[model samples]
Target: MARQGRKPKGRPVSGWVILDKPKGMGSTEAVAKIKWLYFAQKAGHAGTLDPLASGMLPIALGDATKTVPYVMDGRKVYRFTVRWGAETTTDDTEGPVTRASDERPAREAVEALLADYTGEIEQVPPQFSAIKIEGERAYDLARAGETVEIASRLVQVHRLDIVDVPDGETTVFEAECGKGTYVRSIARDMGRDLGCFGHIVDLRRIAVGAFDEEDLVTLDELEDAAQEGREPLDEAAIAAGAKARVTDFRPLDDYILDPATALCDLYEVTLSDDQAGRVRSGNPVLLRGRDAPAFCDEAFATGQGRLVAIGSIEEGSFHPKRVFGGRH
Candidate 1:
């Protein structure tokens, strides 16, 4: 008898997919769906979104996964609705009602409250949150009928605007904030300040750093494309003039983005081929050009607009801190 080998796993798919997550689907679940749809070998998400919230969920596959941290540190914009007169344990409608008030702040009063929230402010996250307390999730503790204490931290809110007064019980708001700012905490604090308890009735993330709502792709679109066999995986190999191999997955080149896109916030530095080689070998390369970006803490090094490495500037030299593999 001949020896048998192990079956192959997933394909080496790489890129980013901005998903328009629907309500009731957790971020992890959305990632799993996308990963399976693409049959990718490696995948991850930039940020965590609760099941009750829906919006842009940036899924990073393959090499793009290395840049997930940059996307996570970027700014975020959220549109949410606050239901006045009642508060919930989870800070959203999913949890049981914890308190109620007859008073509802008027539109003028809500507008006045906006200024206080803008800029840096201290906020304590909700008890029903993923924040860890003694190695266990705070939500887990709360679910087990245990008290959880979350310390307050400073978070920045760049902009907060009241979009509309939906009804006597609800107020819609759009907020642009830095990383770590929680929309639920904003609603909870605003209600307390206005002498009314409140909870988030709805929440949607519209933007994350450079990625806006416009770039979102729905799950149905991906599934339908998979079913129709729009572009087979072997097409990718054929296009590259390589040997064709059999596979049952759609081509993801159109959906995936170059890893360089994630480093848009950093300045650019072009290096010679020799420098690029040095960078790829995990060594720092000298940078010199008439248009060199002013010395900064970090910059993206490239060879003819193709990413070579992400490095730092120290003492008139560019240090290749994290070099990328393969051509862009």
Candidate 2:
């Protein structure tokens, strides 16, 4: 028998990739392309963008996948076009025409409808969505010609701006909302309020969490850059795309941001060198001088020390979740 090679050791390549997803491609396809490009051992996207939408899709690689859910829970902003006169089964252009109306609401009427969605409201997700139905995906159920009735959930629309009326019928609007707020659902509700039926003809997510469209690199651009012997995709390039959302940790001299920057938004607790070492060893460290709130899991250093770990405080001590550095 041939000699077997030894398994590789140490950590694998890990980071985040912010892709400017193109229209007509599913989120899974984008993730696969990136995985192939980097030859990553593991990869996952923070959120899913519809085939009709194009914009920032944050992909987490290696250990960064553990932090994806925390990033995905952040706010998102989108610019979408609502076409008056018809509604689709999926609420976007992907589905068949389920309803139609000849009444075209005036531009002002559409603007008025925006107010109704400005605050918290219940939203019924479209049938052709990724939502699970009795352990199966809702979209799968819908495609199989099965009746799927998804429950309505409350979502917040922080800001809804009517950017332009762009004629008498269509409305171009920008929305900043919490996670799970579907722009297509907004379009459908707006139509109902305006005494017309509408559906999203074009949808583009401009921002997700702190990542923005400006930081996005298109698939074509990334491939072109790779072919020209330019910079290859790596953890650093991937981290750059997620930089906008990461909080600034450098006090003044240090300028480079790492993947840990993503945790900067959380309230920080400084630890001494001894305390940090213990924390990295997975011990609970008691914090002082701060009344840390729940969900704040980050910790900084007191001197020229490195961040040791992220921990949750309970019973007056911090229990480490992730460890980075030790006494130095």
Best by lDDT: 1
- Give the TM-score of each candidate: 0.88, 0.79
In candidate 2, stretches whose alpha carbon ends up further than 4 angstroms from where it belongs are 1-11, 228-257, 269-277, 285-308, 314-318, 324-328
Evaluated at residue 56, the lDDT of candidate 2 is: 80
Q: Quick one: how many clashes does candidate 2 have?
A: 0
lDDT of 1: 0.84
lDDT values for all models:
0.84, 0.73
Give lDDT tens digits, candidate 1, residues 1-328: 9889866467766668899999999999999998887777778999999899999999988767888999999999999999999888888998888889999899999999999999998899899888889899998999999989899989999999999897899999999999888899999999999989899999999998779877888888776666665434476677888742324454444666667777889987778888888888988766576666447798888786677778888766788877776421
Off by over 4 Å in 1: 1-8, 230-251, 272-274, 326-328
Error of 2 at 183 (Å): 1.2
lDDT of 2 by residue, 21-95 (tens): 999899999998877655456778989999889888887666667667667888899999999999888898878
